[model samples]
Target: MSLGEDGPGTRTRMPEQHAGGTGRRTQPQPRRALVTVVGVVVLLIAALAFANRGGKSDGSAAADGTSGTKAGGAKGSSAASATAPTGQRPVTSKTAGIPAGFAHSVQGAQSAAANYAVALGGVDMFNAGRRHEIVATVYAPSVSAALQSTLDRAYSADAEKALGLTSDGTAPAGLTFVSRTVPVGAKVTASAPDAVSVDVWCTALSGLAGQGSTKPVSSSWFTVSEKLVWTAGDWKIQSSTQKQGPAPVNGDDQAATADEISGAVQQYGGFTYAR
Candidate 1:
């Protein structure tokens, strides 16, 4: 007896031996038949084991939800979609024109950090009165006064002139000043019952836009980490710092004209970011 060319559990018959004179034939050897059967069973068992191993590996990959093979077996990262929605309703109220009344959870802290980053990096930061309002609204009382004092000097008249803005932080005649921060994503680094630390990745547009403008609008990427505390039933920044990003490769799209850029900025309104 021998195995056939087909994969597993394929049986082949052995020729019978002929008797010398009585024209009688004997059955194939029982031991040989037994050996053939055992070989076939072992092959079947191995095939099943290999199939199971592959199934388990695929299941593990699905559970991770971070990566997978694409068409033609090329691997691709799924990290961008790893953030799952929490299904909680976003804050519907504003305190001093900033989103407030966050839920007392990690997601709430992340949302607050992202919105605060936006408020801090806005064009209003160049205006003394508006900057003071923003600082007071987003920051804890313990730090707002000092922060406002520091910012007042930082955005003084000399700084405005250096940036081609007037003493009032307004753009020159026939020009539009652009300073906006858009939060890309947020992550909670640490969490507690009444406090949390979150890092918000952001991209900003700044400078002046108009014909023959020396300070053309430009884009930048950065990350802001904020330590927040739950004060008066809302999240407020206790302290914060910013660092250069996590930026992507610059795209090769053609640059828009100054008027087009200025128009787009004016037409589009900002959003209240949530995790």
Candidate 2:
């Protein structure tokens, strides 16, 4: 991000008059070039300050109470645990096999947002059939129908190519399509009896993980803010947006080989995140 500064202030000075019948004007020369140079210098300094503002990985997630990995929570902070348990069993019900019927509280809304983030960012989103089911399951009924067509266009053929999937969203033979988001924690930014906003910080791993793969699985950090509405007995997704990270510093761990990444993804099972 860059910062802009206002141009330097300028003042007009009155010319001097000599005490002679023949009137003459005398004035100090305006250092217009110096003023211009000074203004430019100030702007450059401001821009640099703004750019360097977010350069450090200060062990925090996004600004304003966003959940981030490691640095995001206090030491031993169950910060990930929003108001937990709602005295109800998790996954009380499922819509199209996606979790639904969350408790109508801040905790419940946070839980719903976290789980929906996983479903929305999953590899299933790449496949048309599965994507439709997932969207219908998670999105509000009022918007789901219209959103389907809009989403189909957004995730076009070119998008699939970029992800190493076929135009139809299938991975090539002998390859595994990987897309998973693990939520670090959830924060409720706003709430009401019928509407709520929750921010979920997550680490996502995406790309094809297989031998001879050109796009290998890699991780990215991001924050997703979701507006949810309570309707027809459950919380439904209204809208969401994602932004890049307050990512943590990389450790000195050795990088895994492509085969290793593929094997791990295949063998590991994902969890249903909740508050």
Candidate 3:
């Protein structure tokens, strides 16, 4: 998955740890590929800036019907092996122009990626300062500033209310906000002395409103291809993109209650994904 650009306020909600929101995925459904070609534009909300959020525009591109680890070949897009990683780290240092360092192993990249994904998908994205910090922390320098400003406005106070969030995105009373990102796997796409690109397939828990909603926080699988630059011993996003999925058969596991959804989100802390 390689992203062209990120637009703030692109959707009506932000993800909670398990925020009962994200739409459901039934792998048995037919595929009518819907490729959302988002323009290179960033929105600065004239009003309710932080209120803005993003979601899949109905059905998105299906690996248009490809299998896990095998889809990249269909499109002639190079990707790393899909075999499970041997979570390890490199020896002394891995360099990228400026003073550089990277974890010597795939596990390290996974850990970093998972944590970055959580941060990227978390409720914190609504706050101005936090938005800047997160974009700066996860993204490469080349793309941070613009993303920060756009996100700052996109996650405005107005954006919050729409998703049933406080101006800062917290659950009310006994209700807990559910927002989470679970990494399914990671693969190296292209690695260089200064940068690396990894694709992370994941399940994102999001949504709001009532007990029964079209967008229930059901599991979904999508790949996030990140191009990271080695900076100060850490990986940062240069750019990223996402596509529908090599999603597996939907499970028969019964969905949880909203409260259970909230509880599960609170109980499970996401991982730092890698490959």
Task: Please name the candidate that would achieve the greatest TM-score relative to the true structure.
Answer: 1
Please give me the total number of clashing residue pairs in predicted model 3: 37
- Candidate 2, clashing residue pairs? 59-71
Model 2 lDDT tens row, 178-230: 66667776766655567766777677676667888886666767666677888
Identify the runs in model 1 with alpha carbons over 4 angstroms from their true place.
Answer: 1-84
Tell me each candidate's TM-score. Answer: 0.70, 0.68, 0.62
In terms of lDDT, which candidate is stronger, 2 or 3?
Answer: 2
lDDT for every model? 0.57, 0.55, 0.44
User: TM-score of predicted model 3?
Assistant: 0.62
**Which candidate, 2 or 3, would have the higher TM-score against the true structure?**
2
Residue-wise C-alpha lDDT for candidate 3, range 156-209, written one tens digit per residue: 566566555667655444444444456665555444445555566666666542
Better of 1 and 3 by lDDT: 1
Candidates by TM-score, descending order: 1, 2, 3
Candidate achieving higher TM-score, 1 or 2: 1
- For model 1, give the 10-residue run with minimal summed lDDT: 21-30
